[model samples]
Target: MAIEGPFWRAIAVFRVASLVYATVLMAQYRGYEQPMLGWLVIGVMALWTAGATFAYSVRALRRWPLPAIDLLTALACLLASPYVQGAGQGAAGTLPVPATWVAAPVLAWAVYGGRRAGTAAGIVVAAGDLWLRIREPDVPIMINGAVLLVMAGVVVGHVARLAKQAEARMQRAFEMEAAQRERERLARDIHDGVLQVLALVQRRGRRLGGEAAELGRLAGEQEAALRELVSGTAPQPEGATDLRTLLTRHGSPDVTISTPATPLVLPTETARSLAAAVGAALDNVRAHCGPGARAWVLAESGDGTVTVSVRDDGPGIPDGRLEEAAGDGRMGVARSIRGRVAELGGEVSIVSVHGQGTEIEITLPA
Candidate 1:
């Protein structure tokens, strides 16, 4: 159901309850200028209350014009209070004929247009009440009552807005879950059919000799790329995860992590990809550097960009070694690290020399 349904129903109940309260008050304060006319006005309030309840229950009727008419009707009822209760009685602090019933339209405006609209509606009704004070020299304005009316508008409107935002987030989460399920189904289909065929071709071609070995190499590369595609690493439209958390997991006696006091939040996909790139760099460290080698990861964020640096105190890359590795189809640096960063609109810089340590700096748009 729509979030506004309960609010409208609550307003309906308030109107009915307030109507009953006003009727009992009218019976106690019976000295009106025209008692018969006052009862006729009460009848009108009953009809209008029923009509408004029906109107507000329909989503199509809860627009600006309906609320505007509702507010105007409320003011009319408030203005008629002096005639119905006698101006002298009102001056003695007698409650208006509609009593708390006047607040119903303020709530309607709140549910329709949010805090500002509700406040405006409250002001209009308060003005009508204040007009009575001006017309009768002895009539005292209830400042607290006016303030309460305005406060009700502001508070209810704020609550309504929050409800809408929560509903939208819930809807998006459901959509993302459905999309994830569909992706998993498609991945299963492809893995069973096309992926298996590619793997078979890669195996058989490599066994067939010179030209076939080259074909097998190409097939193996395609299979790897396709597998990555089916890995369910799509970017999400909502939520953020801290990059510091992902990096901290790599910390140990040999690996050190330095991060800001505050969180280094990024889109979930961006953070994961960057963390994976750092993982790839660490993998290279474990393969080339000895098991006892040490590494440090530093994460920093500022000025619309986030940078993560992975440094290792180990024998560094030799000149032209990365290029040779790429030529030999060993793409640890060329594909895993660089490809991931590039996809996130980021840049990767590697500084390394034969005997010195190596540092990989990745900078991404925040």
Candidate 2:
């Protein structure tokens, strides 16, 4: 759309130049038998050129009527060529009334209606010019002029169309980026306040027992569901988000997270999901290994892949414990940790010893 400004300005400049060229040609030829008529037509062309230049500068005025009037006026000038120059003057090398000034209308049509309108305007103006010069010996020159007019129209129209399409795509991308930012902001707000409160209620209710415990369990379930919703793995917008920036938020005194000083960039959704999976692993440590248990999260990148390890210095899982939990319909590790990583074309491996500790490693293509 910004290109329209420069295009119209160029059209204005072209009109002024063509007007001067037509004036010089007419003065040199001195072929007008009707002097007053010749001067009157020139006056009309000059006034119209000024008016069109001003009208096109204002976007609202650049519509059908302006270009239509412009084409008709140019055609009228071409038709009046013989009368103004006298019967045999056109054959004696007299110029058409508007001369090169006719290109103004052709360009206007091209800008407004693209290739089709441009070609149509060119054909109509060229037809009128040729009709007036039908008996001239230099008929080939008129034919060549017509061809040039058509080509100019097509080229200008094509450029205008491409500019419009590019502008549209830019607008859509801007809007989508704005929406993505808003979604992330809302997700952050929910994660910071609502999810934390729900998780606390669930944990406390189980300790209190009775109906309070039941309420806490319900809240905990809702919290897990909400966390999933907030950290949804929807396809990201083009480009990468810094994974280190996202994971840094999880650092605490009891749980230490170590990452490379350099930025770790991945698709926006992938980074969010990976961070959520890490959070889920930390949640498991706090729930099963006591809140005071120490945990370390380490991130490493190499060989076109990234690996994150979450290890806890707490009693390790007993053999078949995970299977027993799954049989009882508890899917904390199954869905929250492994499921999230697997969706990103990654693999999750669990290593645990009866007394020493437990470690979970997630490896994904970079």
Candidate 3:
């Protein structure tokens, strides 16, 4: 059951207990301006107690009208106490006819509308109790009941508000757990079924040489895309993008991407700039080598820095090739990859050894 169930039940129990206490007090003290009229008021209190308990127990009935009526009822009973016990009785330290029974509405308001509502209800009842002092002449004012009423309203209301917040947090936690479980189950199913078929097609296409090989390559790309989708990378918040999500999009049969298992959250513009730089490197591999040449993209984040490395299995760039290209106005390497990284307060390092392929590593402050 929800946390609120126990609160309502407790309120119901308190109402019943307070009602019994009031009945005993009224019976014990027979002195009154009108004894029969006082019992009539007690009868009204009994009926209202039963009605309030019923109303509060129903979820739909715990609204403005009910709580409003509840406070008004309690105030009526409290004010009636003066007439029932006579003005001098309360001034002489005798308990009111309703006694502590009037605090029920305060607790109800606290539970219904939190601390402020509870406190307001307490003040209303306390004011009515204090007003009784006006009826008594030349007697020391008793404010203990008023003080206790206000305190109960404030404390109980605060507790009820905290309980509501705790309940909300618990609900969100349960929803996230259930979603994770479902995602894991789906990932397992895809790994066992579709992933195996895609892997087989990729292997067979690689063994065969022509159009079938191309078809197999496409299948491999689809397989890679599927793997990333089920990798349990949740969507990032607005204005923020996970670098892995953008980097993984570049994954293919010929191109592989490796990123941290956890999210690499960055500003949307930063992640996009990084991913675009990586894409340029891959474009270089396809332009320099054949389409069949493979590449790997590695993304790492640590020590307040983010690094991405794009390495391609292609004939390495000849010595001074980038400088030569920049001199010739062929700025693919200088402009596309290097310039983008440099603008973002980062440095790019290109390593190429004749037969060992080329690697471009970009590092940025996180």
How close is each model in CA RMSD to the real structure? Answer: 8.6, 8.8, 5.9
Off by over 4 Å in 1: 89-93, 201-230, 238-364
In model 2, state the lDDT of residue 180. 73
200-221: candidate 1 lDDT, tens digit per residue:
8778876885677557656765
Window of ten residues with lowest summed lDDT in model 1? 228-237
Candidate 3 residue lDDT tens string, 123-239: 888888888875676767778888998899899999988999998888877877888788788899889999899999988998895878877877887887788777766757679
Order of all candidates by lDDT, from best down to worst? 3, 1, 2
Clashing pairs in 2: none
Worst 10 residues of 3 by lDDT: 84-93
Q: Rank the candidates by TM-score, best first.
A: 3, 1, 2
Query: In model 1, what lDDT does residue 63 have?
Result: 78
Model 1 residue 217 lDDT score: 51
Give the higher-TM-score candidate: 1 or 3. Answer: 3
Candidate 3 lDDT for residue 292: 83
